[model samples]
Target: MASRWVLVAVSAAQLAAGAAGQVIALSEGRAFDIDVLGFRGSPARLGRDSWLLGTGLSAPVLMLSVQAVATIRLAAGSSRGATRVLGSLGALMTCGYLIEKEARGALSPAGWNPTTTPAVAAGLTLAVTMAVLGPRQASSSS
Candidate 1:
């Protein structure tokens, strides 16, 4: 029961954070562009129509939504296997983000920042916890 609630809370947090990021990106494109793309130039000079940026932002939001739904299902007494699968998907999304940040040199100068590292950690933790818990199987009564 406690584990289920923990999963719910973590999933909700991820969903909220992902939504907030999208809102920020839409409302303040320049700032989002600089923080994410590591643009050294002025924010005002940054263009907003990059498909790469759209893809980058879309993936996490989608995964977070999926995780939230899975958490809800788990809370409703769904099988742990389903929840674990969704959790793994979320972790995979986080892994991709981590790799992207590394490849883009985002973590090179400042080490792990507050932006995506926490999300990656949370996702991985959730996945591991779910995996450890294992699937809830039906009882076979005689």
Candidate 2:
């Protein structure tokens, strides 16, 4: 349905943005610039290329999840609880990335990196809006 496609497109965009952020972090030589919670050491120094991969990996997951929600919404005429959870999680991730980027100063946290705060904010806003908007059953013909 058109709605599902829209969700998929939105998710894809988010994923792409995240991937770009990660690339930026790596290129800037500050990959993992933000400490993971209490842990220290940068991912770049740790030789964690997988971390970068992880950023890329998140895109599919979000896309798939959005597609699933789209299907469920189309079938049931409402967004599932899972979508809400994902939205909240996304918001948290966005905030964490923002915080890390802010802490890094000049370097930004990838995979939700806030160096591009506006993008992050937009993503967060979209996620929240989608969650709140729930889903409308796709018209049989439309």
| CA RMSD of all predictions | 7.0, 7.2
Best by TM-score: 1
The CA-based lDDT of model 1 is what? 0.46
| Model 2 agreement with the true structure over 36-114: per-residue lDDT tens digits | 4643345455336424222211222344355345445534543445344444545544554444543234333353444
Instruction: Please report, in order, the local distance difference test score of every candidate based on alpha carbons.
Output: 0.46, 0.43
Q: Each model's TM-score?
A: 0.51, 0.46
Positional deviation of residue 54's Cα in model 2 after best superposition, in angstroms: 6.6
Give the top-scoring candidate (lDDT).
1
lDDT (tens digit, per residue) of candidate 1 on 13-121: 6556455444543444422223354633233532343222322222344455666677677668745654565556555645544544332333345545466445334
TM-score of 1: 0.51
